[model samples]
Target: MIIPEQTRNNLEFDKLLKWLSSYAHSSLAKRIILKLEPFDSLENIQTRNKLISQCITLINEEGKYSFHGLANIIPILKKARIEGTYLSSAELYTVYRQCLLYSSIKQYIKQNKAIVPDLYALVEEIYEPSDFMRSIKATISEHGEIFDIASDKLLKIRKEIKEIAASVTTHLESFISDKNNAQLIQEPLVLDRDGRYVLLIKAEKRKEINGIIHGSSASGAAYYCELLSTVELNNKLKVIKEKEKDVCREILQKFTNSIRGIANELIINQRRSAKLDSLHCLATFAIEQGGCMAHFNNSSVLELEEVFHPLLKYKSSMIRKSAIVALSLKLEEPARGLIITGPNMGGKTVALKNIGLAVLMAHSGIPVIARRVSIPYLKALFADIGEKQDLMQNLSTFSSHVQNIIPMLNYSEEGALFIIDELGTGTDPSEGAPLAVAILEHLLFRRGLIITTTHHNAVKIYAESKEELINASMDFDISTLKPTFKIIPGIAGTSHAFDIATKLGVAETIVEKARSIRDKKDEAYLSVLEKLSEQMRDLEIKKEVWWKEKNQLEQKLRMSIEENSEQKKLLLEERRKLSERVKEFLRKSKSRWEEVVQEMKAALSEKAYSEGKQSIKEIEQEAETVLKVSIYQDEEPGQFGVND
Candidate 1:
């Protein structure tokens, strides 16, 4: 989205920038945060989301990663790019660190292609040839000290430097140990002074010494002197040291040549890495804030639920985070705008701000702190939230608001979201309220999402009368005389100016007088609104209580049903076992009766049949009683009578 700079400040997107930029590892990333704009294409936005997903994974696993060459090399790179000069050894080391970092990442991405496909794809965009990195690593030490192996001539000259330095050390040691020269020596320590080896000698013995005085001691009692015998050798060493520097520069120049060969690669690498860093920071911010990604659509269908303002979400130390309420605003085809009216300090401004800030954040590709949010991919934002008085230009707040609104009216697109706080507030309501309605009409005609707040009763009444504009309010508790700090949709606030004034210590007599001075029709209208607000407030509280109780009942009912079902299964299992026992008893009775009947028949022929019949009747009666008892036991008290 291409919002104006002033619009950014009005939406307080800078505060969001501060929060996001804290996680940036480089100036490049920080600059990206500052210059954030919505991507021009949906593909680009999805690409960024993919990058963010990878960054989130990386960060959660290993935490913060350092950016190599960020501390000292950025400015040097710029200088090299503009000036085209050979770099020093230390400067080349910085570039080497950068190259090494990217090289390592490239290798990692190549190996873990399946794990981090998006990140690996991003890494593939850079044309980093590892040949220069290998050369630089072989040449430079970890401490930025160029190795002797960097150049052959430099190595040979350094070998000569060591020899010359050894000879000079021998001469200085001999002079200190000499009995004749021992008395002249002060501390007997040889030191390098102005690129020449020198000895601290007594000032009184300076005339006896055959050397040049280089510097005097702080007390002026001794002189720092270089021996006349070692001058030729020192001069030769100086010449070789200069050559060493030239040779080192030549080696560094060779590395610079390697860089220039892949100049385009370096630029591409930096660009891609910088974009990666930016994504990393944004993802870091989103994770910290517990936010989710927002998608875009073509129409002005804005549906935001449970979204907190960025300022309130990020820098709300003074306010309790749990106490801060998330706002919900939806604007569809018929509902083109929302007109919110509420008591002072009742979060109307914050509601308006949340709408604008969320739109901007989504358009800029930073996820919003909402459970679910869908907004139009707007091209511009129109906001008039803050004090816009221009002292130098002699413009009033109304004039400034009008000036901002003018451009918006001319260029505002169909999917734009307009946020106006306390609209029609800077002037007399008699005229300002009508102006606000007229502007609302204009915005409706343009077909955009407009969310505005006002205390003007006329604005609220007009909004209530209109079918297209929805009236909303921040609920306030009349009993406690405090704001509930919640947005209640389809209800207009009473805007109890007199009640608030009285609560703030205005005299009761003054309140009464003010009430008496009002027009009867206006007073009656305000009175009816206050009554409606009370009714709505009570209704909302009751609704909340009802919903809470309903949820609790539902949970309890579910638990009870589950427990009863388990108990019923146990009962059914027990009944099944009892029925099997009854069957077993009947089988045993039949077997015993048959055996007895056989014995009776053998004992007495005439009475055998009658005895068996009696035995059979007794067994049948016993089995019938057992079945009745089992049936009675199977019918549990609640199970038989209560089923939905």
Candidate 2:
């Protein structure tokens, strides 16, 4: 839940957050996403899952409703306080528009219950008992002006002002157009200044006009003055507007009081709407990028099938024929850890980082990018996967990594997943390997899941020695001297370091000299491990074929039984019709039964159908073709010989 800021940056979680928030329509929704944390309880987590699932179903099946006004009105709801609020007419109109929007959303969801029942429950919270919009509409017009029908006293004053305004305009118009005053007036149009109607008259004729002098124009040649007759009525209209404001204030206060009474309910509704917005955004994101909901279990097991590193997948999308591959891993009670070993750039670090980021994603209630994943309730997920050299703190990468692990392991308990990369590389391998083993032993007693990537032979050996720990490796193709990026479980891996260097244009003589400098026993040990890795890869391929055949056989048996039963029923009907031909039909039925038995035997036998399957060599050849592998030349093929 509390993902360290550094960890977030390491996983590029901020970028992921931005991607998710981009789908959100409201600022409140975006804010909620920014502040997302893991739920406290299993029930709470499941509840969130249910809501998200329903929203996904809604958007994926039926199109989403218009979320236009919802975002605009969210600020008003956020601004509304718990204590009380005296909403202004503009603010009240905001609440009114939200009322209409929610009402429409509710109506739309009503017909889509089959698609989204849980979503409907969220929408139901936003429906109010009172028609808030009706009250707002009755008092205020479309232009935010208070209507005359709002109050009788206000209406009477406005009517009287209108009649007085007409009388003032008539007098002003007649005086301006007259031939006697034609030279006196600047223009015939009358202008209203501060609620008083005035005429722009010639400065020389200003004294002649029978009007009270108000003000003179900029040129000082003409005067802008109000007539003596309209002054008293202008005063009346000003007083009436004040009264109208008081009346409007009283109406708004009463409206605010009504809102305050339902303030608690409104807040709850506001929260629900925010929740719905979040669901909508997540659902849309999931649909956009193929993502699956994770399954939960009571058992303390970690399983991931076909899981993609989300950020990596996004990056791979930029290139044509993207080369990013998904990862699959599992750790149950019996196997607490796995040591991933391979040549350089074999994706060992990526695999470790991938697991850590994905667990964090799931922990924070986000749908992970996987075809299928099942995880138990984890206390936490601890990761020490990347380079953490701190120059400011004067810490080397090894010391930084050690500092992280020491404290994490001190407080670590059962039900946590710990991931580390390059476990014994940054320090002396002699001491680091033993230290890593010690750490693993300590974590094992705690019953936590531990996974680490290493090129250390000692680490791989230690892993193989423990039943609780397993060894896995990212496969490197020997012929091409390129990493295959395939994880081969339960097998130790060779570094394949010198081979890669030679392929990358290091002189063959220099590579051979480096290999010879290594202890012969170590060389023999690594060569054995490399052979074992290859054997394990072949075994894995065979195991897959075996499982595939088993599943197919089971399916065939099931279908055969069903079809056989149906055929027996039809034959029984025929037997009932022809008593004379029963024996002949029985003979034919026996022959058909023999054929079915033979077919079943052939389908079940391993050797009988194995011939039709392609050899592992052919599979590898095709894979090499697809990858366009470059095979480096060797001085002596299949022999680990040194060149002079």
Each candidate structure's TM-score, on Cα atoms with residue i matched to residue i, is 0.80, 0.76
TM-score winner among the candidates? 1
lDDT of 2 by residue, 184-228 (tens): 888788888766889998898888767788888888988887877
Report per-prediction Cα RMSD to one decimal: 20.6, 13.9
How does candidate 2 fare on TM-score? 0.76
Which portions of model 1 miss their true places by more than 4 Å?
A: 39-46, 61-64, 68-84, 107-116, 151-153, 217-219, 318-323, 478-481, 542-644
Candidate 1: minimum summed lDDT over ten consecutive residues — where?
625-634
Highest lDDT against the true fold, candidate: 1
**Global local distance difference test of model 1:** 0.73
What is the lDDT for 471 in model 2? 80
